[model samples]
Target: MIVFDLACQPAGHRFEGWFGSSEDFAAQKERGLVACPQCGSHDVEKAVMAPRVGRKGNQSGTRNATSPARTPVASEALPPEVAQAMQKLARMQGEALKNSRWVGDDFAEQSRAMHYGERERETIHGEATAEEAHALIDEGIEVAPLPFPVAPPDETN
Candidate 1:
């Protein structure tokens, strides 16, 4: 299923509607099957949405953006030394995360808390924007990114 951010034109209340595809959303809206959750307004349209795309082949199946599928780049495209080093680094990160907590999208907030002594410091791994990571580093908070992405726990089982 696909989810779209919807907004009521009259009331301007934003909400989400799930459908099987883009056509599904259009059909429902045309049929007045979609309505604003806040004011029960039927004059709803698509709202601004955040890009939700993540690493390719995410086990979570939470694709936020679609890209034209492309052929896989072969390992032969990289220097042998680089490929070896990357493989080694990926394994190391996977092992390290065995003891680290998955903080999801709250990495910046949680890491800052530890830096400011608002919370106890512990190993954590999570998704963080480049800006958020830089901010934490600027604040003298120690944060490092994983060499490889790990599937979210919720989607792993």
Candidate 2:
């Protein structure tokens, strides 16, 4: 996997996206599958990122406590336990979404409707802007972001 720092157009909301490769990123973006989690915008572009290079094992240096530690690259191998945990989490999400309805871009509206008793309360999963989600929480409506991105049913192969 490869990780890229991405920023959405106009809103400029920044986030990290993981893809199998640069080609995969291009393909997804072309298909409008890549979108800003914050604003649900598909107009996104790669943000300038500094390359991460690890020091040699023999290199020893005094590091300031205030300095940030290097983060692990997504392409690196994961510990077995970590990998298993991620798989388990994915399975759990899948199970939970099994009975959930997909409202696509109407997530916030639908959630609001249900919250206000305008619509029957039911399990739902869909896209919502960060602002919308914040507003939902502020209104005392229960909402949570999915651990992993879900492909819209209409876009699934």
Best by TM-score: 2
Each prediction's RMSD over C-alphas, in Å, is 17.4, 13.3
Scored against the true structure, residue 99 in model 2 reaches a CA lDDT of 93
Write candidate 2's Cα lDDT for 1-157 as tens digits: 8899999998998889999999989866764678876566889999999876778898787776899999876554666776787799999999999999999989999999999999899999998776788899999999997767798999889
Candidate 1 lDDT over residue span 1-157, tens digit each:
8888988999798777889999878765654567775565889988989866656673766533675656776422556676788789888887898899998889899998988889998999887766787888899988775545466799796
Give the Cα lDDT of each candidate: 0.77, 0.86
Off by over 4 Å in 1: 1-80
Q: Pick out the ten consecutive residues of candidate 1 with the lowest summed lDDT.
A: 73-82
Scored by Cα lDDT, where does model 2 land? Answer: 0.86
The numbered model that scores best in lDDT is 2
Clashing pairs in 2: none
Clashing pairs in 1: none
